[model samples]
Target: MQIGFFAVGIGPSADPEIIALTARTAEQAGFHSLWAPEHVVLIDQYASRYPYSQDGKLPMSTKVDILDPFVALTFAAAHTKTIRLGTGICLVPERSPVVTAKEIASLDKLSGGRFDFGVGVGWLAEEFTAVGVPWERRAERTREYLKAMKLLWTEEEPQFTGEFCSFPKVRLYPKPVQKPHPPILFGGESTPALKRVAEVGDGWFGVNVTVEDAKAKIERIRSYAQAAGRDPGKFRFMVSPGLGLPVELDMIKRYRDAGVHQVALGAIPRDAKGIKGEIERLAEKLVVPAAKL
Candidate 1:
């Protein structure tokens, strides 16, 4: 099992010096990847349900400092040599597909093809409303956007005409260094989310699930993949055992045994000093054991 981290590039890690230190720390510590979450805007209060929290509220307040995932990852890419980087979940429907594609391709090219695109048709309806995106048919919008982006990355002379996105033939230069494109890891645990991954995702970024839940979800996703005529063997399964899970060797082993390619620990303390300390500790306690697994 590859040990990675979720909730990177938030709070103090948004600072340039701190991001350099944190990114290099993870790379040197043998972590597999550093994944950052995205929320373009946050309101003090919103009615949208936060699926991970019991009270249907976000863990963060509007004052929390969160960097744009692409910018944050690009900064980390410049600061590190080998540790992989990902958008733990970029809100796909909230951004333009053509612009988003350029950002992903640019990041991949700049990062030497080390980027993973973990995306979601976001849940916060209020945020969507704030961004002027319709709250309805978001899943369909995400699917169409991804199709358009894929064409941009893979085709030399690309053109896409879809219900949500359309563009004329154009030369998209600096194509992603990754062949075709970087891995598209769909995020979420909903049935539609799993089915969406089966249809288009290169992987699944399951959030806030335990080892047992991870196992069952992976199996279910595989079934969905088979039903969709996709090869489950080609898909990567990445899980984030929530903050409450024990980050012990035995726990890591159980996740590995569950066929998880990578297991991500939840966000650490938000301060730069705290972030650095926690990652170093997790490196010793989790990365070493996971590598042996």
Candidate 2:
């Protein structure tokens, strides 16, 4: 099992220097990855429910100071050599695929092939509207955007023609360091999302599901993969622990047994000493002996 940390990167609580230090230290401490969440801006009166929480509320802290994920990851990548840099979930439909693909590919090139592109179709209606995207067609748009991105990543003189996007053949420079592009981990729990992951993505990045349910979800995802003519074994399973603080090693082990390849604990407090202590604590309790146990 690969143990990792996920930070929201709230500006006041998380400084760039501290974020970089945390990434470096996580690498030194034998952690597998460091993930961050995205929110370009937050509107208090969102007309959508936050999927993970019972209340449809965005955390006030997150809304107040969320930093841009790509820039933060770029900063963290500079300070760490081995730890993989990831987005817990970048909402893709909000931005143009061509530009987003270029940025992500650039990051992969700059990071020496250590970028994991975890993505989602976002739940907040206000957010999609704010970005000038149609909320009703988010799922379809997400699918098309990902399909378009795949073309951008793998093709030479890539061209895409679709309902939402169209472009003539154009070459994307500084092709990703990772062959065939960086690993794409799609985030969502719905059937449509799972099907999308099975058909196009390299992995499933799920949120808010417990291990017991995750086991069932993985089985369903495998079924979808099979139906999509994909080999299920090639797809990775990654989870972001929402609302929960640090989880127990035994619980981590249980999730592994249930088919989780990577586990990331989110919303960690960002004080340096406190963050270091938390990292060491998780390493001692979960990661260091995770495989042996």
Candidate No. with top TM-score: 1
User: lDDT for model 2, on a 0 to 1 scale?
Assistant: 0.82
Predictions in order: lDDT: 0.87, 0.82
For residues 218-274, could you state the per-residue lDDT of candidate 2 as single tens digits? 998999999989999999998866645557888888889999998886456647787
* TM-score for each predicted model, relative to the true structure: 0.97, 0.95
Candidate 1 clashes between residue pairs 3 or more apart in a chain or in different chains? none
Count of steric clashes across candidates, in order: 0, 0
lDDT of 1: 0.87
For model 1, residues 1-293, the per-residue Cα lDDT tens digits are 79887766777667787778778888898988988889998887777888988888887667878899999999999999898999989999999999999999999988889998999999889899999999999999999999999999999999989998899998887899998799999988989998899899999998888888889888988999999898999999998877646678888788878878998884645677877888888888889877987
lDDT of 1 at 268: 43
**Native-to-model Cα distance after best TM-score fit, residue 275 in candidate 1, in Å:** 2.3
